[model samples]
Target: MAKRFFIKTFGCQMNVNDSEKMAGLLRDMGYEKAQTPEEADIVIVNTCSVRAKPDNKAYSFIGNLKRLKKRRPDLVVAVAGCVPQKEKEQILRFPHVDLVFGTFNFVKLPQLLERVKREGRVVEILNRKIPEEEKLPLVDSYLENPFIAYVTVQRGCNRFCTYCIVPFTRGRERSVAPHLVVEEVKRLAERGVKEVHLLGQNVDFYGYQGTDLADLLYMVSEVEGVERVRFTTSHPAGFSERIARAIRDIPKVCPYVHLPPQSGSNRVLERMNRGYTREEYIEKVQMLREFVPNVALSGDFIVGFPGETEEDFEQTLSLVEECVFDQAFVFEYSPRPFTKAATFKDDVPKEVKNRRLQTLQELVKKQALERNLERVGKVEEVLIEGFSPKGSELYGRTADNKPVAVEGSEELIGKTVEVEITQASPFFLKGKPVTTGVRSKR
Candidate 1:
């Protein structure tokens, strides 16, 4: 009988892709996936450490798994991802955890599982080096809709920003070969996937050692049946004027960029070791806007950092007003172990950070709503992802990556249809298919 397994993933889209690959490997080894953890012979928790919430959630989930382990003594419980990489010793202290795999050693899960089952003991496999691509499992995305998929072309980061643990946990930057990336995209496109999002810690740093992101973008756009190409987590420092020009010229690439400008205050940015000054970041954004006029820009912001003064907070607000990003993912700074910032005094008070975060969020939300409102009555070609979570309507994303909910049949899934926007909100758009019953007769 084939053993059953379950994997619960946390954190970013990259973690989701990692879970997909892990699941594929298990499936190949005759392990069927269980809908829930309670029924599985093996349970995996792919975790994150980017923020405090997910870290707490991962630990709580692990604690709950202890009951399952007690119920089924033979059940195998493994912890993977950033948390495992960061807290290997602490996680291994838990008796129920049989395998502790880290970010780099995820591809070794199958063999590690065998060892755990035979030994009736625990195994912790977390190597810091980037694993060869061939060793990683190429998992099928068992997504609800097969229309859109995430493909990671690069992994790890070379830049060690003061507040980030990714460099220590994920290692130096490395990219999958351009030929392999295009081949993967082509295969996904042939599988009826309408869109592919290229992922990386610093995606713009892709091909830095060899193959540049622009070259990869140009090649991926040429893949047959690939209608839209997107990449994320671009670093402001790595983005070049030439790359901005390529983005403007690439037809198949989406005109939406998620570049993280962690702090707007140049002093705080310097403290964070972000590698770009406020003026430089502004110039980069300006260059980008010059090339891609209608481009949608989003960014990440850390509101309060160690030793941040009132003046620093004001500077952040001033930068926000200056940039007027389409959307911004604002966060209050939280110290992580091993990062340079963690060693600092962490002088900014918690209440002050909370207030600053709220203020920034309100401004950004207001700006985002205003931006969305401008798109009202505009016709957009959206690749129908499938039914909305609420179930009565269909939903899809525009070329610029805005989500739109529409009334349509399931057949509309995977097809790019013109949607006439009727209503717009900060987060989503309400639209109807342009070619429906009345238009079909024509």
Candidate 2:
């Protein structure tokens, strides 16, 4: 019987894309995907180290898998991704973990598995430079709807924000050639993909040898079937007028930007080593709004950093009121291993952090609801993704990335339809289809 493999992925979309790539590699090695970890001959845990919760969750899941390993001693257990990259030899402390690999070690998966089979256990977290000759083969595992895909334009981060571990886990900044990225988009477009979300640790910094993000956006938007182009996790410092202009000029680029400001206090911002001031961030926001007035803006904010005071927290709330963001992700500070912030005293009391987080969340909720309410009775072009979990209604996202649920059939899944907003909720919009024949075009 052919061997079966199961992978549990944690963290962001980048990790999702990585798991898909790993699945493609395993499929090429004659391994079928298992629906459950217990039924598989091999189980892999893709971990995240960005926060303590995900790190603890990874270990908790692995602890449960220990029993499965005992029941099936032949089962090959592997740990990969960010946590392994950071922990390295420490990951081998888990006796049942038969193989461990890192972020850049993905291409060596098959060989590493082979070595494990022969040598009984292995660790392959070496930070070897990826050779220019190595390339990811075109693989198709999206057997279901393939209308949306994630194309990684760059890997790693050089920013080294005091609170972040991505630089250590994912390595230094390296961008894929613009032509290679274009080719990937073209292939996806040929395979019926209508939306391509460019992924990276810091996407706005995308450039290699004079080719910048604006250049790549223009090239990708020009692809024949790609109707929507989106990118994520942009740093405020790298955001420029050129990128803003590209969003305004490129018909296919979505009008949603997820710029993480971290904190609103210039003092806190400087401490975080974010390299941009509160006023500077606001300037970028102003520029984006000037170019695309109706653009939806979302942001991330970290509350209660090491030295954050009540006044600093108020500055964040004040900024939120000033920006009136369409959406926001508010997080309490949690220091991670080796991050510069971890060295400092976690000065904010737990109760204080929780209170501040609650206040910030409540304020963001009001702003988001107000923004959504403004859309009521308006017509929006929604790219139908699929049916809701209960299958009672079809769901999709607008150009600004707002979730909209409409009453429709499964046949409308992959097409873009006009929706008339009838009701608005804090998190999603309820609408009805206005037309059936209209579809998105590049």
Candidate 3:
């Protein structure tokens, strides 16, 4: 009988991709995936430390897992991801945890699990150093959409942003070989995948010497079956003119970008170690707009940071209004253990952070709603993903990556369909399929 293992992922898309790698690794080690915690001999929780709320939730969830282990003494429990890297010793203080692995230590999990079973004791393997050659397993990808997949082209960050722990937890920048990335994209495309999201800590900082992100994008666009390409979390400083030109020229690349600005105030941005000033960021956005006129833009923002005054917060609000993002992921500053910001007094009161967050959320809702409303009556080409969990309707995203719910058949899955926008909301759109075929408007 094969051992059953369960892995729960919590965080950004990068962590979700990590879970897929873990699953593949476990399968190769003779363990089958368990759908639920109760049925598994082993359980892994991939965590996040981006905010206080998520970190607290991870701890509470781990505690709950401990209770489950008490009910079944033979179970192997592991905690992985950003939280483990940040609070290694603190997590070891817990009773039921049998293994604690970190973000950069995934390749050692098979051996660690064996040690836990043989010794009948706790095991930990989290070191904050990128390996000279990190090898990720090629297990079956458990993605929600077969036509869409995320392939991480790079790891870690050199930018030691004050409020961010990624620089410490994930370590310095490491780029995967451009040829390897192209090969992976080619394989995915051959597997009937229509879209691929090239993921990294900061994507625009992709390649150093041989081939840059622009050159890599051009190579990926030439892959046979790949119909669309997208990427995330681009740093403003790295969005060079060469990359902008590549995106404009690549017909397969999606017309969407997620550029995190953190703050609009030059003072706040500098304090956060963002490196790019307000004017530079604005100029980059304007440059993108010049090349890709219909491009949809999204961003990340922090509502309150240490020493953030009313003027600083207002500058953020002003920038938000000026940029008019299609969507924005807003966060309140949380001090991660090893980051520089954590050494400073967390002087911004919780109430003030909460208030600023609320203001930003309201503004974002207004802006998102306005953007969605503008799409009304437009016929957008959407890749049919699958049925929506809420209803019998099929679901997919526009070229701009806006979610659209449509009445579709199972046959439509993996195929592109033209959806006439009938209704639009702040977050998603409701559409009816006009035809079975997808064609470019241009």
**Index of the highest-TM-score prediction:** 2
Predicted candidate 2 versus true structure: per-residue lDDT over 1-442, tens digit per residue: 9989999989888887778777777888899889999889989999999887888899888778889998899999999999989986667778999999988887778899999989998988867555331155445453234678888888889998999999998888888898888888888888888788999889999988899999999999989988899999799999989999999999999999999888999999999999988889888999999999988889998988999999999998988888778888888899998899999999999999999999998998898999999999999999998888778999889999999999888888888999999999887999999997477542
Which scores higher on lDDT, 2 or 3? 2
TM-score of each: 0.95, 0.96, 0.95
Rank list by TM-score: 2, 1, 3
Between candidates 1 and 2, the one scoring higher on TM-score is 2
Better of 2 and 3 by TM-score: 2
Q: How many clashes in each structure?
A: 1, 0, 0
Better candidate number, 1 or 2, judged by lDDT: 2
Q: Write one digit per residue (lDDT tens) for candidate 3, span 53-104.
A: 7788888889898779888999988999888787788788888888888888
Which pairs of residues collide in model 1?
A: 207-211
* Range of the 10 consecutive residues with the lowest summed lDDT in candidate 3: 131-140
